[model samples]
Target: MVKRCSWGTCNSDTRYPERIINVSFLPFPKPKTNYDACLRWIKACGRPVEQLNVNKITRDTYVCSKHFVGGFPSEKNPDPFPATGGQIYEARVKSRKRKYVELEHNSAEPSCSVPEVPCIDHVNPIILSRNENDKDTQTDEIVYTNLDLVAHNLSIKNLEEEKNALIKQNEDLKMQLASCVEQDFKLKSKRSPAKKHKQVVNNKKFSAETVANSNIKKLFEYYTGLTYVRFILLVNFLFPEEGINPVNYKEKRKEVKAMLLTDQLFLVLCRLRNGLHIKDLAYRFNIKPQSVSVIFKSVIHYMYLKLGYLSYWPHRDTIIQNMPQQYKQEFPTCLAIIDCTELKTEKPSSLKSQSQCYSDYKSSTTLKSLVVTDPRGSVIFVSDLFSGSISDNEICKESGFYKLLQQLKDQGYLQDNDGIMADKGFRIEKDLGELNLRLNIPPFASTATQMSSGDVALTRKIAAHRIHIERSINQIKNFKIVNRRIPGTLFYNINEIWTVCSLLTNFQDTLVKM
Candidate 1:
């Protein structure tokens, strides 16, 4: 076993013991046998406690002889204080005293005597004497010089001059700092009035223009569910002739407040995206809650009409071109993936209405809608809201999706061999077969207790590709207006709000990028 010094900066090791002369590695005192000594040794090593755990110390752990007094520890000096310039002098003094005592003991015979020199005050002397039967001792004294005192006084004078110079320099720096501070105060005072006026104007009003430019992207996305650029694009799209259309639009609705169209759009988007209450919006926009309600309804209606075409069904060529590779390989002819999503709503006061809206699937009152997306994750069609109690088959038939497909097929936008992928709950296989359209869904193990390997693989493949539709639905629900429980106050506009939110998600970046 090789011994290694545990001191942080030590390179002493038994492997190369010859490199360092007169150095010996000492084992750490066993904590069980000498706990206090072991702790002292560890502390003297100058290593962090975490790096040197006492319990983990093995026989190989060591501290080099250089760390102890007298080059190594001994009974005479058991402590392991590190050997330093100051400690070496103390050790030498103790050794000299011990040697003198030994010499006295060795000359114990009656004739063997050693003379001691007497110490005199105010004199430096060198005296050497040999004992001779108590003869008088002779001493040589050296006189002190005035030169030493003059040099000491000169050093003191020089230090005082240096200190005075540093004090003067510090005072100069302070004066310069004060002048700089005064100039800064004057500059700030000159700009304060203009800055104060601007702040007051900004604080007294809340509008789209008030948000800092650097934070527009994040803040607009938060409040509008769209970036600043996208929000501007949306604004331009909806109110094309902004100056003429918006004012006329507001006047036609008999809205009293002369608010900007951008502010109106911002208010509506905030209400929908953040789910903020009417009174909260009123306070924010500094308008009556009644005006807020009217603006929200009018803007939502205008948006619903303008953005309705966003979810129109695409041509077969376009769908095929944008389909992902995973779908291209397994579901090459797949046209659209369909899934149903439900939004929880407040309970109705009427027992009959409650019974109609209560869904066993969610164990709550919900309004369900069917969402359809192409293989590349663009929403193609979104069905009208249905009672939550309705089944997938009932909603599909009632949603006019099959009729729309037939119509698209008649217009050559769809073909006979194209497929529609859906969850197993849809149960629209026979219905699709009548229209010469293929139904791609997972297989059910109804025929036997378990499905065969081929059926299981088919189900796995279909389910894997079907997940994109779920992602599309998730993005639509990202709009908070349709995500949370719908308030009774907005129950009348829930359908339009839900439809508008579904269409708005298409304006976002494509879910499955090509």
Candidate 2:
């Protein structure tokens, strides 16, 4: 038989046709001697055997055949020798060194099971190298590599941008706050300011001498047929005790009547009524043109209130009974002869007033008045004041004349057999037809027909009848107070003066004819 293998040899396999023994399982024949030899071998490898510290044999200390094939037996293993412990263990010295080196390179801790590293994509490798050198040197040497310098510059730029953004936002907020504060201040200032209290004064004083000397008293007596005292009594009866006293009563009545006789005032009104210039009236009255204007306005106000009633059209029956016999037979239901006339006024100072007062017909500043007359040249009605800017049709509608006609119709006073005569400006034919009233309008006369014999005969008759209206307007305007340009303050007074003049004309006509 072949000599059996003694120590540290493996013998057992039919494939090799020989018995093999494993050295790891071999028992130590001389323990101290073998252990010393193993220790010496370990020391010769330049690794310390004392660090292995293998003293006993155990399963945990055993190394398998796989470990031996990998050639890991070294001092780095827990047990390098198998004869002492009857086991072998593998060393991972090179692997551990490699892992430690990798961890340092990546700046990460290593684990035996797995290794983790911070994502290197976002980190600049150049910057990482600098950091490693700095760690070794323990000195903060600012290695400004292209990537490291770019990163630092970018960081600085970002910081500056953030600071600028914050500053801009701060300024915007301040501006908004300032605006709000200013608005609040304005609101506070809008409130009303404080004012001192005032005491009421009550004093009654009259001048007998001045009253006696003023021609107003004489004029008042002539118009009202009463002294100041009697006139006050009549006024008291009409108005009852309101706030008016003897002093106010005397003053107002004297002022009202005296306005009609004022030389300058009367002259201007006479000029308006007769269509005369201010210079003409000024010469006639021996007063300046400016004085004429002042007087005219005063008189207009005085007369307007006193005579405004003349503007009201009488009832149909009243008009009929008062009509002349010829007019009654031909146009028994004739209510009024309507016409438009322009009154001259001063040039307006404002553009709007100039435009308003300018009349196309007169090519001057004028106020248009609508005059209505009966057959006897007596004015029965006049319209309220209107701008010369308006058309005749517009004035008629705005004057409430249509409503007045409707009212007459509803009252059963507008007779179907009756009619109204008007110039071409009225366009009243269709309107009167709707009310079952007739309209008599004259036809336009051409130059050829105006000179014809038959035309002239018919024209004469028509003119004779139509002339009454013109005469009536002339009579109404004859009042010196209505003949001239009225003052702006006395615009309403013009209406009153027109009415009073109309009433006077009616009175005169009645006294003379009837």
Residue 450 accuracy (lDDT) in model 2? 51
For residues 1-514, write the lDDT of model 1, one tens digit per residue.
7778887678887788574578887888998989967875665565754688797677778888877766778765655663222232122122321122111223433232223323435424222233454335332222222332333344456456667888998999999999999999999998899888875564356666664254445776777777778888888998888465543233343343567788888888888788888999888876778888888887888887778855379889988888888779898898899999999989989898899999999999989999999987888899889888999999989999889988999999999979999988989889999999999888889655789899999999988888888889998888888888887877888888988888877778888877
Best by TM-score: 1
Which ten-residue region of model 1 has the weakest summed lDDT?
Answer: 96-105
Model 2: residues with Cα > 4 Å off, grouped in runs: 1-312, 445-459, 511-514
Candidate 2 differs from the real structure by a C-alpha RMSD in angstroms, to one decimal, of 32.5
The alpha-carbon RMSD values of the candidates against the true structure, listed in the order shown, are 20.8, 32.5
In model 1, how many backbone clashes occur? 0
| lDDT of every predicted structure (CA atoms) | 0.76, 0.53
Find the candidate with the highest lDDT and give its number: 1
Q: After superposition, which runs of candidate 1 have C-alpha atoms over 4 Å from their true positions?
A: 1-205, 212-217, 246-257, 309-311, 447-449
Clashing residue pairs in candidate 1 are none
lDDT of 2: 0.53
TM-scores of the candidates in the order shown: 0.59, 0.42
